[model samples]
Target: MDDGTRLGQADHAAGPRPPGVIFTMRYPSDVGFVWKTIALHRDLIARAFGGEARCILAYPQLSPTSAYQPRWSTAIQADFYDYSAENRQRLERVITDEAIRLVVFMSAQPADVDLGFLRGLGLRTVTSENNSYDHSLRQPFMKRLAKALIRRVLKRQVFDLHIANSQAQYDFLRGFAQLPASRLRAVRNGVDTDHFQPGERTGACSTLGLDPDRLWIMAASQARPEKRLERVLEVIRAVKDARPALPIGFFFVGEGENLAEWRQIALGLPDAETYRFFGRQNDLRPYYQAASVFIHGAFRESFGLVIAEAMASGLPVVATHAHGPAEIIAEGETGRLVGRDDWEGLGKAVIEYLDDAELRRTHGLAGRARCVALFSITRQAQEFADLLRPFLKDGAGAPY
Candidate 1:
């Protein structure tokens, strides 16, 4: 918990020089939860190599890329996504001409980056994710067979280290994926403490146009099926059915495939007028500050970053007691934990926070303190950089 002193004392630069080019993808600058993380730590990664960082972003689609993108200069057209011959050529040309060294894979998901090109780097490339998803259904028998043959494309030797944010990811990779624990390390995900602190509910409600008198709960993640939106709807439905007069507000932040369906469900709610869906927000501070509780029902979430953000904003959480949530939310300290697929249990927990101000305050305070102590990015990056110390010497970073 006392990670500040540890960060202050650790010699983060006591490691060896990097092998070469550092590769990563660009995320939209305004997607607060995920983008804010890179925006906060981009400099630390750059400084790790003394500004020798050469990164290639698959940024054809995103806008306002890399808010505080590092100070190093390289020679290449600031290209977009790599689906075409021209785009692929621009990327390959940059890699070949620059003699790129290492690749740094963040954001966990491999939706953007070129997995093959990074493998060709031959130096060391590492990837880190907040948590792991249940990709068991993603591959079929033929896909698995193909992956077994071409899986060399994803060989670990190319990536010297695969860092995870919580024990859930660590155990999944070790037990199911069969990755060596020595090659993978678990670190806590962080939050922007300065921005996401506890604030007066009055000011927040006034600014965000939320009713200060109503009991509001929020779930701030992409509205995907895996996020388990049905449970939230069911819980609110139960609470509203029993206590029809209860003034409650439900807010969903971010967007995804099930958004239209979720909106339909929201419209049928008893307090449909109070329900709010803010799509693809770049800033969630106001939402966190204004809400009474943050609830999550994801069947399999990676690390639950928004939970920490909410805690940092001094909001109580009521998350299901599953893999990722088990690690982030202490049973009674940060918020209540209920069973998954149990709408009654989740609803009762929601009602508990709604009615008890003292309980919410106690849990919210603990969450904020925990976030400040354990989930700070400075601590995460420092511990992670320690693991990369042994792999940096082969870097061939030429700025092409």
Candidate 2:
């Protein structure tokens, strides 16, 4: 991995433009949320720094699911297969070559990489933790202890700034990681309200081959153990048991390893014939528009991005009282929040929305107003700029 040359060699050969920001995430999946965050905020970050700001992106691999071609800035593929001295030296080339002023490490996994080296190069540093309730935080004593120790060790390297996706995440960093409050900032994840807003329901369900007239409930999340999608199936079954005569359908979007298991569970339930699985999708607006209610069964999240999107789309949401959702959902207003493990409560909430059309409309309208007022991408971008203002002076760097 070594080119056998010092960092200065690459810097000497670089262009005359001011060193811009470089965001490092080992894997940059095209359809993944992190990539979407970069895409949404890149231009705004650049504008905040300077009109001529150039943002460079570095990642280990492109996701196979989405064809992610970078249109806004330069992309560097820095393979992190081996975190050896040679690889570290080679990775530094991307930084030196681009003359990056500030380096934002997007994931907590790689934040410890080249710490002293980055400091020596006078590169401003920032790190972000996106998971509010990490699954390991719920593991058994020995495993949890081991993870805590590992996390503590990995985060020994301090940053100029720390970004938390939600207040819960911000609290986790301060409490568990002992990150200073001065360095921590909680910026809730925002949605593209315009793209995900309410629309005509005429073809919304039919386009997915679903009966538009029947009541449809939608849940979108990666089908994973921690997400508790199985509980969603249980909620569906419980709802059916409680309301036998109600004609209802369930629609699930997004895909993961647990998707097959969820599908199998969905197949065996009563009225299971109405279960619709629209695997990983690039467009989710139609699903949100067609649904009578939006349901989220995840036990935890860094920030409930999908919940905000659903609200923006004017759908009444029923989600578990997970870390992010507990903070996001306005109970009995925009949506309802049940205990994370309460399947019956989840079912009851769903049924309430199903039985009453007036309830759905009232909650949906309120949710939309709340989402638009509080969680727009433009608002988040500005918050980022405010947080990053101090660092972007004369020759300071950009945040990711």
TM-score versus the correct structure, for each prediction: 0.80, 0.84
lDDT of each prediction vs. the true structure? 0.66, 0.73
Top candidate when judged by lDDT against the true structure:
2
* Alpha-carbon lDDT of model 1: 0.66
RMSD in Å for candidate 1, one decimal?
Answer: 7.8
Residue 93's lDDT within candidate 1 is 51
**Pairs in steric clash, model 2:** none
lDDT: worst 10-residue window of model 2: 1-10
The 10-residue segment of model 1 with minimum total lDDT is 1-10
Q: Candidate 2 at 362: error in angstroms?
A: 1.5
